[model samples]
Structures are given as structure tokens and as C-alpha cells.
Target: MEFGVFATMAEALDAANKAQKDLVNNYSLEQRDQMISNVRKEFEKINDELSNFEFEETKFGRVEDKIDKNLGGILNTPGTEVIKTRAFATDKGLTIEYSAPYGVVGAVTPSTNPSLTVIGNGISNLAAGNSVVFNAHPFAEKSSSIAVKTFNKAVVDAGGPNNLVTMSANPSLATLQEILESPYVKLLVGTGGPAMVKTLMASGKKVIAAGAGNPPTIVDETADVERAANELYLSTGYDNTLMCTTEKEIFVSNQVLDRFTNAFVESGARLLSEEEANKVRDLIFVELESGEKVVNKDYIGRDASKILSDAGVDVEGDPRVAIFITDKDDLFVQKEQLLPIIPIVPTPNFESAMEWAIEAENNNNHSASIWSKDVYRVTEFGRRINTSIYVQNGGTSAAFGVDGTGKDSPTIATPTGEGITDASTFTRRRLFAMANGGNYIL
Candidate 1:
């Protein structure tokens, strides 16, 4: 039998609360591992369908990108492996610490991630001995429901509770508020924009909020220009820059600016003229009555060719990224667009370049990358920027532990200060100590 969704938020919360108790009291670590493994299997089975559902339903991001996100969320996201019990032994006594779950977690997933966020949160939440009630973004409810169903089915098949992973058939702000206010929901994890993050923080519950980011990728004079350009463009274009860690701005040292531009162009990045850049800017961003600038949303994460065409530029091939050379003070250079549009700023030296990169990041402290052979300069920039993710000689993928530290995460929780959350991040740490106890074995 297929999995099902709850008719009301009340029903979903009740079912999830019971499921959490069952999961914590009845299931062992081994059982949890089996459930997680089965969840991965389910993702692999319907990877193609889930990706398609997300793209067609949300009309945001590409199918291929969704496939990667699905795999990452299901298999690569940190689970029980990242969660650890710390122990210290002395001559007199032994002190140990344990990680415990917060019972039921109210996880609000975003439209940008939808199913990916649901599965990723599900794996970690369950691994930490908690059940989740997903409050999906309304824009991608269908796809998110499919993901929640997959998680619940896989968990049950692997000998877990029936409603261990559940959600409402229809998601709304009211439902989210209900979940936030419910006593049955012991903890909260939210991934979305600033408004959503602020609300989660104000819910009076312990919350892990993954907020906004405007990541900057800086290239210094010491780096290989062509390689940096190629890698930078590839990273910026990935999934049309929908990922929070995607590079929004590029800061290049003037010494290598020309070569970098040539290489960037060769890597299928289209450079927009100043006149064209203004037009593209107007097409992408809109100023409100309060003079606040926001993205057009419709064009966000769309194909670069499609966005460029809509912006009135006729192009033959599909350009991977749309880069505009603009002043450091340009509005396009300031705000986070979440689109394939990239702004390039040329600095006289690496110091000025780093400064510009830092300014562009705007203290979000989420993600930053650099292509440089100068270790001193890289360290200097890294120290000053102090972002959660720091990538060197590569894109945000590498910073997500791809070919680097290997500490990948779908939820880079910035506002909460728990960067790159895994199973450990979801658990509460408790200490146990023995006063003057005997040592057992060697």
C-alpha cells in the first residue's frame, strides 16, 4: 500500500506526536539504520519522478538539478554517523555525554528545496530518534507530499512506526503557526527566507533556522585564471544558483581580470553589456513602495537561456551563467538574487578584492569561496569573512564537502549558528559522570 497524507494539520500533529513516542521507545539504533537505508533506496527508486514532480509542480529549478539534490538529501546528508556520544576516562572516574532527541520536530521546508529539504530533514531527525511533521511551502506541496510519503513508507517498511514521517495534504501559514504553537512539537527546524526564519526564532521553541545568504567567490592574482573562471561559472550556474551556497558575486584581482573574463566567456558564460545589464537588472529586481528591492521570483532558478531571452537578449546557445561587469556599488552587486545572474567586480589588488567580497557577503556569514595559490591571502580573507562555508579553488559543491572536507549538508543553518547541520545538530547533548568509579577494562 502507498503512503498517505493527513486531512488536517491537527491530525498530522497528533499522528506525528504518537509516532515520535513509538520511534523513541520501541526502535533501536539498528532499526533506525535500516529505516534510513530504506529511505535511500526509496529515493533511488523514484529519483527521476521526484525530480520531475518538483520541476513541473514548482516551476522552479531543473529536473537534473533536482536529481542531484534528491540524491544528496537522501544519501549524503549526515545521519547517525555525525551524532556521537563523548566520553572521557581518567584514573579515578569516567565521564560520558549522550545525545538525545527532542521528541517531535516541527520542520518547515521551503519551496526552493521542497522535497529535498523534507527528505534531508527526515533522515537526520529520525536518526536522532525523533519524528517530523513537515510544514511544506504551499508552492511545492505536491512534490513535498510525495517526499514525505516516501519517507513514511520507507520507515514503516523498515520496521518503524506508521506515521513517523507525516504532513498535511495542504500546507499554509496558519498550519505552520499551528505547528509552531503545538506543545507536542518539541523542537523546530526551518529552512527559508528571512521572514520565515524570524518567525521560527520568535516561536519560543528551540529552532534551527537556515536563513538567507549572498555567497561571494573571489579570485586573486595568484590563482590560475582559466581554471578559476571555469570552476566559478560552473558553480554559479549549478541549478541556476538556487542553492544558498551558490556564488552570487565574483571579485577578481585586476592583474588577472582579462584572462579570467576570457576563460569565463569560454566556459559558456555570457557577459552582458552595461545597457543590457541595466535592462536585465530591471527585469530581475523590483523596488517596492518602501524602496526595498526583491527578486522577481518567476525568473529565479530558471534556465539561463530562458532568463536571458526574457530579458530581451537573443542568444543562440544556452548560456550557463549571465555575468555583468558592474561597479562595486551597483544594486545588482548588493542584493541576493538567487538567480543565474552574477555580478563581477574588478579590484586593483587582492586586498581590495577581499574587501569587496566581504562587503558583498553582507555579514550573512553563510558561504564564501576563493581561487588563490596565496595561502596567506586565502587565510586572511577566510578569517575576516568568517562564513560557515569556505571553498578554495572550487565552487560551493566543494564547500559542501564534495572533494573537500566531506561534511556536506543540505541545511546550512546560519541564523542558529549551527552551520552544516547533521544528525548531531538535531540532538540535545546531556552529560553523565561517575564520581570516583572503578575502571573496567583496558
Candidate 2:
């Protein structure tokens, strides 16, 4: 079974399936660990090149930020350690359950985090003893193909099976369709918008989908105003705010709103006046034929200075974040803007702030955060948001393990309810029972 990019999806699927079988039957857990280690080291060695290519090809995020993103994915994505064996003992017999592979997985990578997604998913899927046939986003074909090829080389060099990772040289909708229809692909993992989630769900296979999010942040009077302001500035400015987890809209308690805004300005964020904000809204959004107003694709992931400049608003210094006050029903609060622009909605009290936070999240249940010192407020906000990634007094990147504890993965399966996925999320449970003394230890 040969790995790397294949001419056809059929060839990739066949080779991937064979490679997954080899990993399961011929390779031991120790061998898998070695392979994963090689993959991580190789990722580090080529991190610069991969990040440069992805940034240049996709033009979605900053190169420096993409570099950090790749490093986070490589170093923090958990391996076989997450998989565990469970056993139960009964009066008559014993039963043990093992984590088993789902064979070959059909993964659809997104353009937003092309190489990061591939490498992270590859590490996770391979760690679970499964091979992957990636349907790379057409816009990021070259970068994604390079990632797949590099991953496969690492596995082979570590004395593991070849074709552990595979993708199409010509990634397109046709190839994605082929993967969906193929019987050999046992599971589906996708990270993209509503359309991608819908497509994967309709495939009728077990799907781990990472969909869109309008993450809302809350800042109450009890919060450390300076700390909250600084963290918000960094979170909304990181990677030009391309991540779905970035705070889109925020509800602030009126008591602390002015102080927070002042501290935010001190942190290099420019507060746009209402008139300037309206101009920005006009510049960043466009109305569709169907009367739907959405963020202009041109401004997505662009720098704050550029976004503000084009809106005819000039600033004296470099500003990484552009924030403005708006009502809860404003389009900026309702829509998930991928740019560094943020909407600040002021509430008279904490209770109203919480209510607005839930409403602004749009029920995506993807990611939300709160800046507060009150433990009761934190607990209540966490429960009310009901999001997969909830941050307490930290930036959104903390949830992804960049500046926080634990592992990181680009594919946050919010829709599929896996939260932050790792190797165990890719596997199934296989139970073994024996009539008497079934469990080996028992």
C-alpha cells in the first residue's frame, strides 16, 4: 500500500484501508508511539515551510500566528494515551471492552486551517489505529497535499505501514463526493461551515463535524477590568480572528463598560465611534440577492488596520482590534465576523448581560467565555452558555491549549458533541466476554 497523494480517490481509499489494517495487525502500541513521535518531529522540522505555504495559498491568517497554530497542534494533540481498556466483573462472568479502530476515515479539511487541520486530524486518526483519506479543500489543495505527503513519510520512516495518510492530488468537490459514496470509508470527520456539516451528516455514517460558531463573551462588573480588557484585545486579534472560537460579540455590564473600554484602548484596540462603526459595517458587509446581509469575503481574516483604513477611518497608532458599541440585534452582533472587528453590547445588569450572551451565541454551542472574579457568576455563565469550549478569565486560544493546560486540536466537534477531539474520539468500543474468568486480571 503506497501513501501520499494519489491520482484518484479510489486509489487513495484502497491504499488507506490497507494501511489501517497493517497498523492494527502488524504494528504494536509501542510502534505506533514511535510513528507518532516521528510525525511530531517532522512537523516541527517543516513547520516554517508549511505555515508559509498555507498563509500564502489561503491568504486567510497571519504567518506568525499560523506557525504557532501548527506548533500547538503538533505538540499538544494527544496520542494513544487517550485510549483505555475497561472491564467489568459480574457474579457469573467477566467482560472487557477495548478501544477499536473505525478502519478508514473520510476527512474533509477546511481552508480556514488547512495544514493545521490535516496534521491534527492525521495525528489523532493514526493514533487511533486508523488510516485517513483526506478530501482537502480545493482552495488549499497544494498545502494540504504537502501535509498528507509529509505525514505519510514520517510514518513510513518510523517503520510503520505506508499509506497511513492519503489525499487526492486534485482535491475538488468531485473527490469529496467520491469519498462520501465509498463503502470502504467507515467514518466521516469534517471541519467547515453549515454546508460541509450538512453534507457529512447526510452521508449516514458516524460523523464528527466541526461547524460554525458565533462565540460571545461576557464582561461583568465583578471582573478585573484591566485583565479582561487585555485578554479580549489579544483573543480577538490573534491570527486576525480567523478561528471560529474567537469572541465575536460581547455583553458588558454598564457599571464597568467605560473602564473596560478605556483599558481596551490602552491595550492597542481602537474604539470606533458610532459613525465610524456604521461606515465599517457598510464596508465589511454586503447584501445578497435574497436580501441576506453577510460579511464580505474580502475582509475575512484581514488586519484591523486595513479593515479600518478601507472604511476611511484613520488612527494614530497600530491597532490590532477594532471594537464598537452596538445593540443586541445589530448585524455585527448576530453574524460571526471572521475579521478582527468586535461588537460590544452594554447591559444594565449582570442578569441582562447573561441573557444577551445566550441570545448572541445563536445556539451554536461552540465556544463562549466570561471575564469575572465571582465564582457564582462563572458557574452560572458556564452552564447558561452550554458551549463546548468555555473560557474563564482567559483568551479563546486557552481553550485550544496554546496558552492553557492540556492538549490541542483544530477540529472542535461542537456539532457532533465530541468537544475537543483526540484519538479516543476516532475509535469504537469492542466488548469481549467469557463465560467464566473472562477478564484476564479477574
Task: Report every candidate's CA lDDT.
Answer: 0.85, 0.89
Clash number for every model?
0, 0
**Tens-digit lDDT track of model 2 for 284-306:** 99999999998999989888888
Q: Which pairs of residues collide in model 1? A: none
Best by lDDT: 2
Candidate 1 global Cα RMSD: 1.6
Runs with alpha carbons beyond 4 Å of true place in candidate 2: 1-3, 437-442
Q: Report how far off residue 151 is in candidate 2 (Å).
A: 0.6
Shift in Å, residue 98, candidate 1? 0.7
The window of 10 residues in a row where model 2 has the poorest summed lDDT is 433-442
Provide the RMSD of all predictions against the true structure, rounded to 1 decimal: 1.6, 1.5
Error of 1 at 437 (Å): 3.0
**How close to the true structure is residue 16 of candidate 1, measured as C-alpha lDDT?**
85
Best by TM-score: 2
